[model samples]
Target chain A: MAETPVRFGILGCANIARKVSRAILIAPNSTISAIGSRSLEKASKFASDNGFPASAKVYGSYDAVLDDPDVDAAYVPLPTSLHLKWAILAAEKKKHVLLEKPVALNVSELDAILQACESNGVQFMDATMWMHHPRTAKMREFLSDGNRFGKLKSINSSFTYEPGLEFLQNDIRVKPDLDALGALGDTGWYCIRAILWAVDYELPKTVTALREPEFNEAGVILSCGSSLRWEDGKVATFYCSFLTNLSMDITALGTKGNLRLHDFVIPFQENVAPFYVASNSRFVELSIGCEPSPSEHAVTTDLPQEALMVREFAGLVGAIKGRFKA
Target chain B: MAETPVRFGILGCANIARKVSRAILIAPNSTISAIGSRSLEKASKFASDNGFPASAKVYGSYDAVLDDPDVDAAYVPLPTSLHLKWAILAAEKKKHVLLEKPVALNVSELDAILQACESNGVQFMDATMWMHHPRTAKMREFLSDGNRFGKLKSINSSFTYEPGLEFLQNDIRVKPDLDALGALGDTGWYCIRAILWAVDYELPKTVTALREPEFNEAGVILSCGSSLRWEDGKVATFYCSFLTNLSMDITALGTKGNLRLHDFVIPFQENVAPFYVASNSRFVELSIGCEPSPSEHAVTTDLPQEALMVREFAGLVGAIKGRFKA
Candidate 1:
């Protein structure tokens, strides 16, 4: 007999859910038990399209979905402005949560989420899909090797897109309730998270910023340059932008040499995808020829790594069920 | 009749003198009439090698060089550790001055140097060679053109080198200084200045940094990453390293396109270097060329664009002499 799959319920039919739903379907030992949206029609459509099991249900309200006895965990893909509210509610219902990136609109929100999760004894993890990719693990290993890149010197990274007029008109990304969740939160967060992870999440000693008041109507940043100095004298600088055309690059320089990530904003894929390593004044190319682990098939979606993230989430759920043993 | 040339003196037998001395020779209406060193033998040797006229003087003590009435301006290149003391002494002697980069150890020292020049009514300019290059002017013009690159998003720059053991041991760069002058100040300053200048020197709202503690013996940064947010929402990042092998590259991303400068640091030649511009997802080769000013040709040197800087300096001196009427 197969092990029972963890039943997942998604809160809100967020735009990102389109991508997350696909991951849930393909994730091993995980099943979509239900879905909820403000509108019953939307919830039903999402459940039917994904072919949720006959016993699975659809709810008009997020609270109804959280209260479902069959749902073991909740994936919170709410807008930045409402992430804290739904995440706290999910925790109150004793549901494990995988909150979306930016985790919360601000540090205070993050703290509140932390407190809620702690009080309820529920497992919580920020749903930073990029972080879940095995390539990120590869990057960390490369950095830790010490003999490869040497002592860390600086980092330069960017993730930008040309979000067209439709997005400019109605996307919550432009709304005020989110409070500084524009480029810095929506896209720039990836660059920030990458740096934080690369440096073992060392808090920066200082931070200064500039913002485009016109585009950043919510006063979040459209493009920002930040310098972070770690206690060990390691430094990094990163840039994020919302108004520019597409660009995703990360370059790290160290004492002995440097490493370049050609498309850091995206996941590794089989084929001509290439990164470069520089040492002794010459550059060597590291190309992706075979599919990297977490999935056997060639990645086809814009975020092909999403399936791996879901699989990992299922494993974490199993660990929790097994008394927190990995 | 030709206007009287400003008689000049150099106050140290430093490597930088090779370039500056040549500039003095080619500078319109200027002549190198005196030189001084800690040892008379060294000073005489420099004077003899350059075929100084019999009327030209050589002095054992730097003070004697400054005391000469024929010396209207003085070039000082002692050490990164001793720029301020001599610059002040030169000002006291009523001589105009050209101090090498990192004009003072830190911003405080820089401010003091500015005050000294203002108080003495003497022209003072930091010899940041690239800042005076004609190509830099072209870059400024290109960036400012709205029809071109469009709204600026990000900047990434680095300047690094691998000095031999002997150079490293004897170099003032390795010594202790309070101004964080090693990598960040020495080589990194070029990247910083380039970013600052590209953005019209807009003061950053905040700055956070990290430095390598090992190379920063006196706590000077050997490698650093700085994040800067301009008031207009533009972001820039700068990285510098003394430990890495030589490499220099600068990239700027804008809304409409992107510009990549492969060898921004120590460019092969002063004029007509090739760069890549990507617009509308198509890459095009763009040649950035500059006409050598007549004054530049006068000062012959092989340090890429050193002669161009000399010509600009000569213009600045002339402008100041004409009461800031440039």
Candidate 2:
């Protein structure tokens, strides 16, 4: 018998939802079943704008979509302030949840969402889509190789882009009421995640925020950086901003090797991504230069990374449904 | 008449001098006139081992190299402790000095040498050979590009190498009475210079050394890092150590582009050097990836960077001589 794909119901019509909606349509194990907005016409327009199937339902309110029996999972692209209410309610309705990044205002809110999902017996995952990139796993393999990479000595990452003055003054990310953490929660989150990812999720023992983090009038961070140190003498630093040119980078150095990639958050091309690796690197004779140049590794995938993320999440949902039937 | 070449007298038979001696030989307008060590036999062995010309003189004491009238300039490669004495003496003796890096034990010592050189009317330049690489000039051109690489925002550099335990415990760098700054003066100097170079030689307004610098039993730093902040909000960080695998990197981010090179202190190859550049980089639609990949730029030179440094230094000496005769 053919397995039924997990049915997705998007709870908000935010810009990111358009991308995720396309992901759901492309992921083999997922399908867009419904979309809801405060305005019925806008929800219908979003469905067509993002190429949702003609059979997909359009609803005037979020409650109508969650109330339907076919929405096996809810993709919440709502602002941070709305995540706690809608996500917990979606869990109460027994729908699995795929929450957007900066999942909650703080750990406590995230804990609440996690507890609700646990109590309701549903899956919950934040939409950190890059974690599902095939290139990430390849990079990890190099970092984990003791003979090739040795001990992790240091890492530096930065995620920054100029969003212009209008966004700084009006974007939901900069508005404290909507996303209180501001750039730290948005861009800096990726930088911090990259550092943690490079170090195998090892938490640093101390974190000292570098002096001079820029802030708006409402005290929302516009740019910031921090340095972290581990007990084992490992060190890491990260910078993120809304004031610089578009730049995403991660550089990890170990005792025996180094890894660098510029487009960590998003690859330049959907089909192929490249990373540079240098193992056992050293200077040439007389130290006039180096020997054994760094080699570039390119990873290609047929499906875009976002689609892969959706496929992975929906596969977990499908497995859970199969368990219930059995 | 043919332009007279600059005559160089080398003080000490240090390991680095062997490389510089070859540079002097390869450079068009420079020639090694003499080399001196504490033992005449050792100096003679070094001269023969390094393929010095038959006319090159070998002497028993550093004083003899400075006192020789035929020696138009002195290349001082003595340990830091001896720099204040020998560098000043060479300047007072009217030999245009090519001093080794970490020019003196402190700024005051450097000032005294500079004062002597000014009083004696001879040129003075530290032997920072990477500054003369054709690749360095190319990188500077990119960084100075306003339309391609707007205002500089941040920079990070590191220079590290593992010389093994035998050298760490016994090398002159680890001895407090000798090269007391250890890794800071040895490896860190290059990193600091790279940061300053990226910002057009503008000094940072504030600098705070990162905590927990590893030091030897004799109070010499073995590993350390520092963060510098410019008045205009530009920031930079640098790290150096004698405890990790060989790595040299410099990454500078600007408002319009970024520049990165894995081997900034030394090129990976003597004949050709490369650096990666990304201009006007931006994420593709939906931030799935980036657009316009960073391209590798290779610069080729017939003369090694060290030899180019010698040619530049010698050209200055020759220009001074020409002006005096005119």
Candidate 3:
């Protein structure tokens, strides 16, 4: 028998909510049960615009969504500043919380949210959608293959895009109070996560920020980079920016091989992704060129990565509920 | 009506000379005229093994090649420690000099060689083959197009290869008295040169070496990296290694576009090389994916990059000779 599908209530009508809402609809084990916005009309329009089911309720206040008996979980896509107040409140209401990344403004806020979730027995996760992509698993296999990848040495990642003038001037990300971490929290998150992920999540021993970070008029970081060194002598460097053209890359070098991909965050297509691998590559006669072209590995997925993330979150909630019922 | 080919005398039988010798034979405007080694037997063996013309002279001493009237130029592939001595002598003897890179132990030595070439009115060129590749020109076109590439913002380059156990132990690059600059002179040179090429040879305002460079037992760097910053706010980073699998890459990010290629030093195939260009890229619907994939540009050449380098150097020498005779 299939497990019970999790019902999700959205806390706000943020722009990112539209993408998550669609993911909820597409995930087999999830459904959108409620949407709450400070303005009920905005919530209604968002639900309609995103094609929410007629059964889904629209709430004027976030409290109404948490109070709903049918809503078992909440997807909080609120501003970074509101995460501390709202995520913990959702957990206090015994609702599983799927929080947006930069999960909270700082460690204290995240700690409070985690403590509330643990006490209330509610599951909590962040919307780091790229982690759930199938391609990531395939790449991991290559990295872990000793015969192919050998000892890990270095990793470099870049995630940057030109956000244009309007976004630079008016977007909440540029505002000091709204998304204060700016490019670091927004795009650099992926670069750092990718480096950690490539090295099997082992924390770096030392982290030195690169010099000459470019900041906006409000002192929000527009571009920045850092280098991380591991206790085992492995090194990683990453750069993230909002002022350059779109470029997403992850290059992992090993003693015996290397792995590279241009689109690590989002694939060119929703279903398939490609990564290049060069194993035990050697120069041909007289060092004129290398032998054996880099092999291309394409990984396919049944659903978009975001949907996989929702399904993964709901599966956790479903397991928790099953244990509670028992 | 074709200009006479420049007669090249090989200074030593270093392994790289094998490749350059083939290139000299292939380049229509260049030919191998002599080869010098400490032993006449070794010089003769090298000439015969590399398919030198039967008439090409074999000299037991480098001075013999420098003094030979028929030798218009000397291709100095001697160990880095010997560059200052041989390159200056070649220029002093009125032979144009094609010196292998690292050029010297340091800037002061390089200045002496440059001064010798200038005072003697002999042409001087460094044998950085990739600089002459047609694909380099093609990539430059894209970078120069303001409408497509805009101002370059950042550049990241990596050049590394696992030379295996024998080379790590016996290679001149690791020897204290020879190519002691090690991986930096051997591999990092290309990374630095490529960064300079991307930005039109403008020197960076500041260059800081990355921490935690791996050194061999002989106190030679096996792997290292550095970051460069320009006055115009352009930044570049490069990594070079002798302990990693073969990997060469250049990722140049500009305001309006990006240029990336996997094989920047030596094209995977000699005849054709490919680079990916993403111009004016933007995230597509719902920020799920990007619009339009990077376009691939392929450039083909009849002769390999080294041959092109020899041809270019020969043309310059031929032009000088024409002036002298007139």
Query: Can you give the DockQ of every candidate in the order shown?
Result: 0.15, 0.65, 0.77
lDDT of 1 at B115: 83
Per-residue lDDT tens digits for candidate 3, residues B14-116, read 9999999999999999999999999999999999999999989999999999999999999999999999999999999999999998889899999999999
Candidate 2 chain B least-lDDT 10 residues: B282-291
Interface root-mean-square deviation of model 2 in angstroms is: 1.4
Candidate 2 lDDT tens digits, A1-326: 66799999999799899889989999988999999999999999999988898889999999999998989999999989999999999999999999998999999999999999999999999999889999999999999998878888888899888777789889999988998888898999999999999888888898888778878899898888888888887788788888777778898888888888888888888998889888777666677776567788999989998999999999899999999999
Backbone clash pairs for candidate 3 read none
Better candidate number, 1 or 3, judged by TM-score: 3
Global fold similarity of model 1 (TM-score): 0.66
Q: Tens digits of per-residue lDDT for model 2 on B1-326?
A: 66788999999999899899999999989999999999999999999999999999999999999999999999999998899999889988989999998888889989999999999989999989899999999999999999788889888898887787899989999999999889999999999999999998999998877768888888999888888888888888888888777778898888888888888877878889889888777766776667677888999999998899999999999999899999
Write the number of the candidate with greater DockQ, choosing between 1 and 2: 2
**Index of the highest-lDDT prediction:** 3
When summed lDDT is taken over every stretch of 10 residues in candidate 1 chain A, the lowest stretch is A286-295
Taken over the whole model, the C-alpha lDDT of each candidate is: 0.68, 0.89, 0.92
- Candidate 3 docking: what grade? medium
Q: Clashing residue pairs, candidate 2?
A: A266-B289, A267-B289, A267-B290, A268-B290
Top model number, DockQ? 3
lDDT of each residue in A1-326, candidate 3, tens digit only:
89778999999998889889999999999999999999999999999999999999999999999999999999999888889999999999999999998887788889999999999999999999989999999999999999899999889899989998999999878888898888888889899889999998899888887778889999998988888888777788888889889888999999999999988988877888889898999889988888666888999899999999999999999999999999
Worst 10 residues of 2 chain A by lDDT: A282-291
lDDT for residue A196 in candidate 3, whole number 0-100? 90
